[model samples]
Target: MLQSFMNVFTTLGDTVVVPIVIFIVALCLRVKARTALMSGLLVGVGLTGFGWIINAFTPVVTKIVRQMVSTTGINLPVVDTGWQTSALVSFHSTVGITFFIVGLILEIVLFLIGYTKVFFATNLWMNWGFMIWGTLAYFVTKNFWLSLGLSIFMMLYVLLTAEVQADRYSSYYKINNGTVGAAHNMENVVPAIILDPLWNLLHFDRVHLTPDALKEKLGILGEPTFIGGVLGIIIGILGNIRRLGTLDAWGQILGFGVKLAAVMTIFPLVAHLFGQAFKPLTDEITERYSKGDTKGLSEEENIKSKKRWFLAVDDGLGYGEPATIISGTILIPIVILLAFILPGNKTLPVVDLVSIPFMVESIIAVTHGNILKTIANAIVWFSLGLYMCSYIAPIYTHAVAQYGVALPAGAVLIASFNVMCRPLNGLIFLAWISGNPLWIGLTIIVYAAFQVFLRTRRQQIWMYLKKMSDRNIAPTSNSNMASEIKKQMIKS
Candidate 1:
């Protein structure tokens, strides 16, 4: 009886079932069937496109790098095809780290100086180091030390360049007023859109005064080390004054640590238990099938046996009903409640939890009009979902690893769960999902420097969109609510 029920539940969660559920939900929400179908089709096409792009670009980058190595005698290692080229991959090195730090500091300094003009400039630098470094690193070297060193150099170059630009005056701002801007914004579409059109864009007049300006403004501060120390001391002093230097913070920290441990330790154990409990169901069928006990059962029994096999496997995942409810209803509510009761006025954790899913849903909800737009947004959402998985899954896996729990062979696990999800989410959001090659790609290289220094998603998104809009990169769409409804009705 238990085996039969487990089988039924497993069947309900299949690949086919999930899409059906998505379709049903979309329909119930008044998302037209055609719109949903198109969106689904687009997701498939985008994934296919992604694969082809990777297959094509990997070789091209490899060929170019090899030639460059041959000519320049850089002695860089050959590219490793095995490593993923996600934002997280880019962030895991010394250079990537340094680049982000410098960009972040510069952003704060510029903000202090009331220089909102630097937002685009900063994003470009940070994005370059992070966005380009990862994909380029794969082609350049395999050694961790070499990669780290090079990444740092790249970050340094970007920082110095920003320093130069910050001190200089602009003759003209990049004009992103309409559809023309949208084409330029498309990553690598034309490759040479003259992002700045000579005199107006170059700030040649400002170049002469940049050194003098840098000296007058930032030279007094001197080296980065001094600035870091000053900031640390300020934080330390504030901590001491507030009496939040130790035990007060420790409890929350420890509680999160415990929660992480539960995810890491408890989840897999439950999975294992479910597996063992259902083993008999599998073994009996396997035994009968292998031994050819055909006379014992009818055609319906045979169908039931296959169905049982599917269910037994699915139900053993252990994250079925309990985890779903915990995540969707209970866990989220508890997190919010805790945020309310446990301390600070800042809803950092709650906001982070809410933001990522919210962003994904919002993007999808907005794209419910056109076919390609809907599909593109869905692919983006899927990509975002993977990022969320990367974020939370690691925390649980790391917790287990820290406690020295040995996982089953071939089981992928996370190393640490960042309970402070908002900042981390913002980092992942900017560096990975938002600027994915499919979304913005190398344009990010132009925009990333602006992004690395900021800590908040709200601020980061605001800065990023403003930069795009100011530069006339974000294309303006002309759809309103009534039009959207009419379009949906036409599609259905």
Candidate 2:
């Protein structure tokens, strides 16, 4: 009975599940039924469009990477099946349903307690985050209860990170209508958090390298589509140079470049559709909550005067930003180069090549859309991903074999950047390898301490801003909204 229900529940997929949740939430918030339903369906349509774009690009990227590997003759033992395969393996686990249920309960508890405002129930498919931890934990300890606890703890960690970071992203991106960015690529969060202080210490935060800056510096060459095209052409040439003559290589390069340019060009349009789909529901909810109480205020002032409410959406909407796409495009060949040069890097990144935008989304956000800073940070993070993927490949292979997953002929091992790159997963793998539970315990402790520190630091900053506001010194609109949102989050 339980298995049947689980199957039925998951059968709808995110295309259906996300919209249904949005509709239900909108109705609960007193949005009219027709408006809510339309908003929900549009959101689904937008998401489906985004998915189609992703699907279209993935095969192209995979073919490119495979060609590069075949040309270079750099064969690593572990096959890189990427996140899709890893997610499938994770979701098929017997413990998968249990993790999803527990994660849902924990998400609700966190939201109700004001620990987080972004309800992850809306992104049900992302429960693979919890499943990864649970499946790995069970593999290590062969104990169900321990795995369950660890999965719950991992979910809590992700929620807290999202809670702390969401407002900053929304405010910076000017994503109006109370929408909060929720990322399933929690691995990116670790590097973002770790590097943030370093970035500040170096005063790199003062540097802004936005698309406008790029345009001013390099004209058409700096445009995202041009950058993507150039990079794609370079990759294609490099991939085929050993196998094809110069003219043939150039032909492949031009063809691939055009395709890549098209993908980058279409990304932002699809992303806008995604953002638009949520706008009506969010606008309605925000309006209903505000009750036209601040109609006389300035446009900026109205944003400040509004109370805090959150509408959850996937972080992918921002992945289409120019800086992110360009940076990610540039990183594809760089990752391939690093695989050969970086010591102990056994896994060659293939399928996850297209996922670079999502992987670097948070970094791009925190860097304030600075392409240079995002690329610098991504290089470091991708280096870590390579090392971590190498470290976990053996265990990953063992777990897959243990679960009776079939492998390709002569492929005894598999690993993925998407699975092993997560800081939480790295920590779990370390604990298992060391045969000491203390490492995992310490990770939890450090995570909890960091969350507390973030909360306290936010409060202190807001308190200072509030003092300025009281003195009639106006803060910037984004800062003002951030302050207001923080206060509301705390009060809730």
- TM-scores for every predicted model: 0.22, 0.85
The RMSD (Cα, Å) of candidate 2 is 7.9
lDDT per residue as tens, model 1, 83-144: 12223433433444444445445544553454332232212212332333432343334434
Give candidate 2 regions above 4 Å deviation.
Answer: 177-184, 196-208, 244-248, 289-309, 402-404, 432-437, 459-492
Off by over 4 Å in 1: 1-25, 76-468, 471-492
How close is each model in CA RMSD to the real structure? Answer: 29.6, 7.9
Estimate candidate 2's alpha-carbon lDDT, on a 0 to 1 scale.
0.70
Pairs with steric clashes in candidate 2: none
- lDDT comparing candidate 1 with the true structure: 0.31
Clashes of 1: 27
In TM-score terms, candidate 2 sits at 0.85
